[model samples]
Target: MNAYLTLGSVALFLALVAAVAVALWYRRRNDRRTHSLHQLLELADCLEGDLKTCRAGLQQAHAVMSLNPDLPAASEQEARHAIEAGLRSLLQQRIWIRDQAPRASQDQLDRAVSNMIETRSRLGPLLKALDQAQHALDDAMREHIIQRGPEA
Candidate 1:
């Protein structure tokens, strides 16, 4: 009877240790997932802000076109194409990160974030072109408005 009780106590102690270890592991894993998710969210927010600016530029371009129909410069069109491509790339990365986050290890999550940061560099020239396009479009729209009466 003494031996049996000792064995039972050891088993119970081993189970408690295992439980605690598992709980600690899960907490660390959850923290990693949360960190990755936060990174993704931050990246997405930056993309969305840039997208908003691009949308406004496009709208201004559309307004200019409505007045002249042929006012879009070749550079403006090229810039728009580049911006669109960058946006598509960002969207794909976002999807990949979200899909992998549920099952990926901490290293994998970090790799994904690093890959996304590298991809984001392509946005630099695209954003510059977008700014130029916005300025051109703004000028075009202003010119159209000035040429026409306030009734327009």
Candidate 2:
């Protein structure tokens, strides 16, 4: 009876130890996975913020151009150049994001890049028009000032 009891006690102790070790291992693995997922989410958030800022800048430039109607020839040229530069930068940024982003995010980045590229292509004429409008307005204001004489 004593021998049987001692053997059963030893078996029970070993079983408990194995169960504890397995639980610890599983918990550690779960924590690592949770941490990795959080990091990915944070990265995604940052990328989205960058995209929003870029979009806002582009929109503001568009709005400014829209408000002006008879800008000078030189001003039109400058605006076109600026627009081209912005478009090129956007294209490069899109390419970088698409390449560096994780597979899960690549599609979203790619679509955004495509849209931006298309918009950029379309902006050339609009930018020229805006420049022309702004320059014309400036020239007219200058002429009015000159005609009015220096000061009262």
lDDT of each: 0.75, 0.56
**Candidate 1 clash pair list:** none
lDDT of 2 by residue, 1-152 (tens): 99999999999999999999999999996665555444444544444444454445545444554454443223444644664666566557545555654443434544554554455446545556655655665566677668768992
Candidate 2 lDDT (Cα, 0 to 1) = 0.56
RMSD to true structure for each model, in Å: 5.3, 11.2
Candidate 1: tens digits of C-alpha lDDT, residues 1-152: 99999999999999999999999999998987898879977977787677667766766666566667657444556756766786787778778766877777788878877776765666557768867877877777788778887997
Worst 10 residues of 1 by lDDT: 70-79
Against the correct fold, how does model 2 do in TM-score? 0.39
What TM-score goes with each of the models?
A: 0.56, 0.39
